[model samples]
Target: MLKGQPRATSPRPAISPAPGASEVFQLLRDGQPRTRAELAQLTGLARSSVASRVDTLMGLGLVAPYGGAASTGGRPPSLFALNPGARAVVAADIGATHARAILADLSGRELAEERQALTIGDGPDAVLGWLAGTVGTLLARGGLPASELAAIGIGLPGPVEHRTGRPINPPIMPGWDRFDVPARVQESYDVPVLVDNDVNIMALGERSFHWPGTTELMFVKVATGIGAGIISGGSLQRGAQGTAGDLGHVRVAYGGEVVCRCGNTGCLEALAGGPALVAALNERTGGTLTSSQDVIELVRSGDAGAVQVIRQAGRDIGDVLAACVNLINPSVIVIGGSLAQAGEHLLAGIREVVYQRSLPLATEHLRIVPSVAGDRAGVTGAAVLAIDHVLSPESIEAACAALTTG
Candidate 1:
């Protein structure tokens, strides 16, 4: 489990900095209830101060009483926790061929979600309009009004200028270049919008929620395209151009005469991505496979040609990741995306090559595993982005002050 914030001083017998409503809310965010005395003791604030902050938070609808704790002696004190239904967050994960939307509360508990087919080639206007309509429907389904949403987050399939939520020269998305995505979305909902690469959000979701203990991690997605999400020291690495871990376009030393979608030749994606694997299998088996899903089904049903190419793709991917492991030395490497569903054939090939080529120390503690959340990782990570943005110290302070006045 994620650890709590370090105490300003020790929890036992020490005078510390005064705790504010944010501090009190953080304490309650652990999903456990604490009485005024317990909170005061933990935060090193006076019982009176604790009460004042708690009352303010209660009025903001972020915290609520959950019944009384066990009484040691005197009267049993009322316990308080975060109200799971106070506000909702809207998160969307837009991929090349599909999109997922989720409605979650302040605590990251998902309320409702919808997944549907969406083509990125349809342009941002059509996609954003569809997203707005879907969000309205989902909010209605969850019995939430539009005013209850605190923020919106989106993960796109291409490189994004994170500050403005705009796609910057995305290769796959034809009409999204330099598009003001956040501005367009805010026109519909009038809320803070966050945008990032789809793989970056997947890495965030994996690290923030699933592997909290992993400070150094990498999430590699090998679907229609190949890319990586790097988390160093528990934060996403977007690099100078917000395209840090773009493993897809990495040029292969041995690849020759293969053209990539980016108009580059001999790129890694052309050599080992899902489309490449499918093309190789189709040529080998003389069968028509339209999508990566077909390749996955073939691998699942024990097709020799599909299995061989997937393993080769894994090794091809591992060759690139071996260099990454030596450079970053991530403690964990989570394999996700469409091809990951092929199971151990792909993982085994990656592990075989990565451990063999990477430094002994790097490979010793490195865990190469498949993604646990699977398809949900993108949406879950988007929710994390929104929740963190809303609960940030600056935002929290402003919100608390506004609540006190309102």
Candidate 2:
């Protein structure tokens, strides 16, 4: 959860800095309702101040009364909770070969969802058009009007300039180089549009959904392309280039002969991504596998050749992650994406190398596990991004002010 604002100083308690609407909203965001006295005690604000903030949030439909709480004495104070039905958020996870769209309430509950076989190479116009249409379909499914939509979040399978929501020199996305994804999507639905790397959002989703308590975490996606979403000190780190987690393109000491899609040699992706794993299995199993799904099924069926290939790929990935462990030392490392569906084979290989090579201290308490969200991690994370955007302190304050004036 995001932190609240600083308190104002005054001589009288009545004039003490009241909690801002955003601050109060954050407290209620957990779906727990509290009386104004409880809020004042927690925030050290005056009862009057808390009431003002509550009234502001209620004005915008962001908070509502949740009936009464058991009173210690006198009349019971009214309990207020987050009003999740105020508006819906649209989330899209666009991959190399497919896309997923979902509508979620402000509280991050999925209202409706749809998946489709959309190609990235289809360019921004075609892809954005389809996504917009999908958003409309979801709105209809949820019985929501366009006006009920508050924000749109997208997770693209490439590096994204988060400030502008544009893809930056993505290797596989042919026509999306520096394309303004948010602006394009905003054309259809004029709302706050957020965009980020698919793995970054996956990391956000994994953390928010499964490990909200863990502060240091890493989400590694091992599909056609490979990347990592880093959460350091409870915040997602994109670094200076928004490619902070491009683990796939990291050079491998032993794979100098391998060519990567980024026109580089010896990248981890070139050696261990899903496509690379499938290709390796074909060499051993006489070309029986084609897609990442094929690789997963083969591994599940206990095919020795496929298992060996995936384990090797995991080892290669672990080689990169070992370095990450030593450098960042995240407590939780979640392996996600289609390849992760192969289960323990990949995790075993990664754990084997990560534990063996990483520093003892770094490896001691580290837990590398498969993703909980599975195939839906991307979409889940996308929704989280939008939810965070709308619920952010600054955004909440601004939106409430707008509503108050309107």
Candidate 3:
């Protein structure tokens, strides 16, 4: 081995490419296998400048020539595209009762995924440790190493400080407030990490996958708790203190005595959330209902009491959402989470209430649709976040070089 090592190879010093390389890579990423002239046209750069940037990107292995364009009375031009297999990303969604991990390619397609039921209320340490292990398992199952990851995106069940990337007194996730979730995950995987509220990430996924161009969108999640992710003008509206979409704490009844996790009485979540609806139904029908799944089954079986409970919850949720519509004037409202499984019964009430309460203009063109992502929305949303960050020009170049062998 020592003799084989003695065979000297040239010590090639790594050279950082010019700044324009990133812009060039972005253009190529946008247009796969685009001709140099086409790239120049798209980027508004001179031919010579585009050529130099392309050469730099090619040297970095972030992009490669695939084929040549058809000649139009001139010499054929070479085309280039991103090296899709050059890097990977990890995404995790940490919910109140479960956590999911996925390994995805640069294009956001999941290569491997894993899920486990883990109580997040025990503390941040236990939940985060489980998350890290799940991520590692996903990477190993996908045949990718930690070094190949470009970044990790995390979705947690709480309001996240976008600037500090920390949870902020989230009601369901006890002891998670102010914890540096991104840094903690990064410590385990040795990669860049990004964290955001779960519903916000779900909104991102919806925008990236389903509604591409429409701007004003609201994603309401009615699960064990209620929250909304507001996207206005193609940007997430976190507002001051990162609690813009904490609709769970919004008062539904003025002086009622139903206390919420936030210590508030008559909050919207205290009325419409899964446990509340189930408790109400159990009290009415004299039957035990454990989870949202049970409630949905009962409603599907045409149980009058269950159907009525869900419908009433829907009305209450819609009343709150009507206020949101009037305030935000969102063009589309997406209802998601376990409660959304009620389908027409829930949406009908919500639609009916919104039309009845909100201003005509606000409700005129507003479309209330159920989520298509279903239970996978959180995982998919987390994956979208990672892909958006990792596939950026700068990140692509950096990741390519980091994963490349000279």
Which of the numbered candidates is closest to the native, going by highest lDDT? Answer: 2
Off by over 4 Å in 2: 1-19
Please give, for residues 1-406, the per-residue lDDT of candidate 3 as tens digits.
Answer: 0101111223334654555577877765543577888888988999888887776666555566665679888778877777555578888888888888889876677889888898889888898888888878888899988888878888998889977789888777889989988778777888778888999998887766788787999999999888998999988898987888988889985529988877879999999999998898889978888888899999899988888889988899998999999999999999998899988999988998999999999988899999977777787778877777776766756644553443
- Which residue pairs show collisions in model 3? none
lDDT per residue for candidate 1 within 1-406, as digits (tens), equals: 1122111211222122233678877787766777899899998999899988887767666667776679889988887877767778999999988999999987788889899898999999999998888889889989999999999989999999898889999888999999999888888898899999999999989887789789999999998889999999878899988989999999887779799988899899998888888788889878898888899999999988888888988888898999999999999999999899999999999998999999999998899999998988999999999988987767767777675455
Question: How good is model 2 by TM-score?
Answer: 0.93
lDDT of each: 0.86, 0.87, 0.81
Return the number of clashes found in candidate 1.
Answer: 0
Cα deviation at 405, candidate 1, in Å, is: 4.6
CA lDDT for candidate 3: 0.81
Candidate 1 ranges with C-alpha deviation above 4 Å: 1-19
Candidate order by decreasing lDDT:
2, 1, 3
